[model samples]
Target chain A: EAGVTQSPRYAVLQEGQAVSFWCDPISGHDTLYWYQQPRDQGPQLLVYFRDEAVIDNSQLPSDRFSAVRPKGTNSTLKIQSAKQGDTATYLCASSFPGLGGHTNTGQLYFGEGSKLTVL
Target chain B: AQSVTQPDARVTVSEGASLQLRCKYSSSVTPYLFWYVQYPRQGLQLLLKYYSGDPVVQGVNGFEAEFSKSNSSFHLRKASVHWSDSAVYFCAVSIDNNRIFFGDGTQLVVKP
Candidate 1:
């Protein structure tokens, strides 16, 4: 089975510039997640969607970050007016809801990630 | 407050040595716990997961995790680690279904 795919494995932008990262989740997966991982740190949740409908975006920076899953298959994460602090790897993951036997343990499949650097 | 904590930022051990990576989570209720390994230039992969029952869960690559509700811990262990096991390991917690939170991660260095 083909895993989740993400484009632009790396991105470099100057402060105040903007960039967009794209993701195509695995087939038949309903839940998609976007996470930001700084250097030497674990990934932090930014936003998530369930079949084109956002489940939770509380952690997303409303002012600068935005994400959309239009067709419920592909997703796009855009950052406006990027700052140096925005330098981190953007990871995209997907999972089928109520998965992993009868327990629903929710195991995610991740992409290699798109590393973004804002200088 | 940090939901999940991996106190050890890095650990080094000789190849074929036993290995243990510590993980602790803060929650009133028992949540689903998972351990993920990130290899060089690769995405994070599931090593194992913990739900109810057994307390000890087996994972890929001869890895396993022991869940302790009283201690609020889920620590990953291996009988003997290979040099290929050198990577960053993360402990994660999932609550309210799929809402997940992750730890800072521990870097394991297995020297030959």
Candidate 2:
């Protein structure tokens, strides 16, 4: 099975610049997620979508960050007017409900991630 | 709200030594827990997960985790460590299969 695919493996931007990371989740997976992973730190959930409907975006910086999964198969996370603090890897993950042979286990499959550098 | 915690930021073990990575979770009810390992420049991969039934669950490459409800813990363990086992491990919890949270992760360094 093909894994999650993310585009622009690396992004370099300056303060106040804007960038968007794209992701194509595995085939048939309905749930998609966006996470921010700083250097040497684990991923922090930014937002998630079940199909085209967003489920939770409480952790996302609403003022500058936005995500959309128009077709429920692909997603894009955009950061407007980026800052140095936004320098991190933007990871996209997808999971199908009831995986791992257990009901609603939700085992996540991650993409290699798009590394963002804000200077 | 549900969250996961990995106490150890980093752990160093010699080859062939037993290894354990601790994970604690906070939730109102029993939640689905997981352990994921990430190799250098790679995405996170599932090592094991626990929901109910057997407290001890086995996973790929000789990885196993024991769930303790009383302790609210699910710790990953291996009888022997290899240099190839060096990687970052994350603890995660899912509530209602919609919201998921991950711990900061533990960096495991296996010395040869």
Candidate 3:
């Protein structure tokens, strides 16, 4: 089976520019996640979705960052006005929901990630 | 609130030597713990996870982690490491129905 896929492996933009990262999750995976991994830092969860609805987005920078999964299959994360601090690898992950609501499949399969460099 | 900490920012070991990466978490509840690895220019890959049951769990690429409730830690271990094992390892913790929190990460260098 194909793993989670992301487009534009690398992105370079200037401050105040806008950029978007796309992701195609694994087939039949109900949950999708977006994470930001800065240099020498671990991936930090930005947002996630269950089907077409956003499950959590408190960590997301509300002013400039937004994400959507309109069809519940593919997802896109956008930054309206990128800043130098936004330079990081953006990763997308997917997983299947488990029988119990609290217990998910507990495994998150990740993509190659989109590395963004904002100068 | 919960968080993860990886004390060592970098570790160097000779090839064919045993390895251990320390991780500690702070949470009031029994949170789910995870270990992930990332090769050069690659995304994070799951190394192991601890939810319940056995304290020791095995993962891909001959990696294993032991969960210690007393210390609030889950450390990754490998009996023998190769040069190919050089990478950054991240420790994560997640509460029920919440997003996963990850540590800064530890870079492992296996010198020949």
Runs in model 2 deviating more than 4 A are A99-104
Docking class of 1: medium
Candidate rank order under TM-score: 1, 3, 2
TM-score to native of every candidate shown: 0.96, 0.95, 0.96
Off by over 4 Å in 1: A99-104
lDDT tens digits, residue span A1-119, model 2: 89999999999999999999999999988889999999988799999988898988999999999999998899999999999999999999998877552334468899999999999
Prediction 3 TM-score vs. true: 0.96
In angstroms, give how far residue A66 of model 2 lies from its true place. 0.9
Candidate 3 structure quality by residue, lDDT tens digits, A1-119: 99899988999998999999999999999899999989888888999999999999999999999999999999999999999999999999998877775556667888999999999
Instruction: Score each candidate by Cα lDDT.
Output: 0.92, 0.92, 0.92
Error of 3 at B53 (Å): 1.9
DockQ of each: 0.69, 0.62, 0.64
What ranking of all candidate models by DockQ puts the best one first?
1, 3, 2
lDDT of 3 by residue, B1-112 (tens): 8999999999999999999999999998989999988888776788888889999999988899999999999999999999999999999998863477899999999999
lDDT of 2 by residue, B3-107 (tens): 898999999999999999999999999998989999998999999888789999999899999999999999999999999999999999987766678899999
Model 2 chain A poorest 10 in a row by lDDT: A97-106
lDDT at B67, model 2 = 93
